[model samples]
Target: MSSFDLRLLLDPPRYPANRYAPLADRIKRLLATHANVVFVQAEAILALEAVAISIARPGRVAVNVVTSPYGAWFGTWLSRGGAGVHQVSAAPGQPIDAAAVSACLERLPQVDIIAAVHAESSNGALNPLAELAALARSRDALFVVDAVASVGGHPIDFDQHGIDIAVIGAQKALAGPAGVSGVAVSARAWAHIAASPDVAPSSLSLMDLKRNWLERGRLALPGMPPPLEFWALEAALDRVEAEGIEHVIARHRQAARASRAGLRALGIEPWIARDEAASALVTSAPVPTGVDAHTLIADAARMGVELAPGYGEIEGRLVRLDHTGTRAKFDAVLANVTAYGTALERQRVDVDIGAAARAVNDVYAAR
Candidate 1:
């Protein structure tokens, strides 16, 4: 396909395979390309619900390694699903190390499933899944990962990393709408789900969805799928495939590097510690002295640049810089930095505008 026609692939159209056949097929293709992987599309929270149900047993425990708000929420979901939830805590801006997880499991012998976030978009921390997955494997526990903000923008090797179940969302890195997200399930995860006697909501049940849509060769129930979002996701996936996942990941890494360099040049330190920093997306420096993060973001918006404020408690204290999806470009990076510099200047925060731009330029030039 030519560059011009790339956009055409994103167009939504009903196909004979099923109402949501195109999306299901796309996800299946992604999973089938990787050994021992199964793909299910649902909100990340819903996916976690399934994972909780799939893995929960009468006496087994599910351990959630919390490094972000999402992890805490998932832990609650696991607990509500009848699994004993063990929270292994890590400070914000840092990741839960594999050794820490291993220690937790060692202390809690009943732990059967290990859940963690691959990238905590809330704090811009990237967990070391490969290492953690190995640790989980050593303990013979199912490794469940939340890759919501990492999948399209970072490197994730389900088979190589030994991740039994990895959840992804559309809005963050895929550059798609929020309603559609997906989860990749390993054979082990499927087995866990299959063995469970707990009844699942028909639409929310991973096993039911798999049976109807995948094994039984039936379309999803009417009014049960997000057609446009699915098409958009397929389009996004096609773009990723064309560009190559490695190249996509490298681009995000480069953009993140440029963002950090620019921020540092402007005398801004990232909220996240250097060791656990994520390349998929960036969280802003803590609110500068005498300046509010909300004001900075508002100023950027006035300058025609959109930036997200930190969610929950961090709101107005930090900003989030997303370098993913269709907007992952050097020009986009330059524009964002320029807008930020402008905003800071307006707020009377000490900022060397030229230097920040130059720092980003240097990274782009080197690339």
Candidate 2:
């Protein structure tokens, strides 16, 4: 490679001190909160683990919700930290039911913390965040939400929902790099972390991150941070600001409607039956009989359209059509439905490509 290329890729300018505070401030603004914001130098999983480590201590009762794999991992993390975790699980390919959560909270009224995923992209289901948050409030528990797949695509008011800790990833609905992530922590959460004797001052400690922000005040990070990813996140936030957040959310919702309508027109059923419970970030559809989800994904890719198979155990049973960030567009919806229809036809399945395309167009037109 040329020297210019090497320097451009390897020696990007360092993040300026003045921009650090603004970056954190912008994230707080995006979440529509005055809560403390800490930008993690790693993926959102690390930020969430930090929250778990800070909150889960011996003798604490935490209700860990398991609607997706991430929730399951959080439950395991809490258990490893000596917290008594009561996992409330939803049926496969379904969002967590408010009634079940209410029952769990009622049974464990002494719970100190509640952890849940706002949207399960794996199954394209949106959990009842408002109801769950209300339950946490009733129990006086710290509400922790994994908003990785919901932010930017769905409406979120951290303070309004009484969310003590919310972890977000730039890679999903934010349309940014996976290398950077963040968390918004409420005063109640900070207090919980400060009181935890087991909470250590480490790289993965949320307390350490909060200290860095308070002590450093508008200065750049203590160590060398990833300039590229930070700048990319800034650019992504700029885009969001340019197109109004509400409009961005509406676009995502519209894309999901178009994708679902198109799929239904092709005789494919959505994994989530209720529109209100489905995630706008992604639309999951079951693979038709005699057809492998992987094969369909491969066929779609060959036609210049990429589709993701359902995560983990659900793989090969369903296909996920992404509608988050840049993918939440009319063009993307059309391309995805057309690809699915064409792939079905290639497999000797009777699919009306014209009808599916028209359905998608109709949805967009209605929007």
Which number leads on lDDT?
2
Which candidate ranks first by TM-score, i.e. highest? Answer: 2
Question: Any idea how many clashes model 1 has?
Answer: 0
Q: Positional deviation of 277 in candidate 2, in angstroms?
A: 0.7
The weakest ten consecutive residues by lDDT in model 1 span 30-39
Relative to the true structure, candidate 1 reaches a TM of 0.87
Task: Please give, for residues 1-367, the per-residue lDDT of candidate 1 as tens digits.
Answer: 4558666656456533454555644554543324232334556677666666666666668878998778888888777667788898886556676778878878885668888888877767788877888878888888888888887677777777777887777677766667666767777778887877646555457776666655755555323455666666666777777887677777878888888888888877766647345546654556677887778889989988887777655677677776777667788887777788788889888888789889999998997
Estimate TM-scores for all models.
Answer: 0.87, 0.96
Q: In model 1, where do residues sit more than 4 Å from their true spots?
A: 1-13, 18-42, 217-223
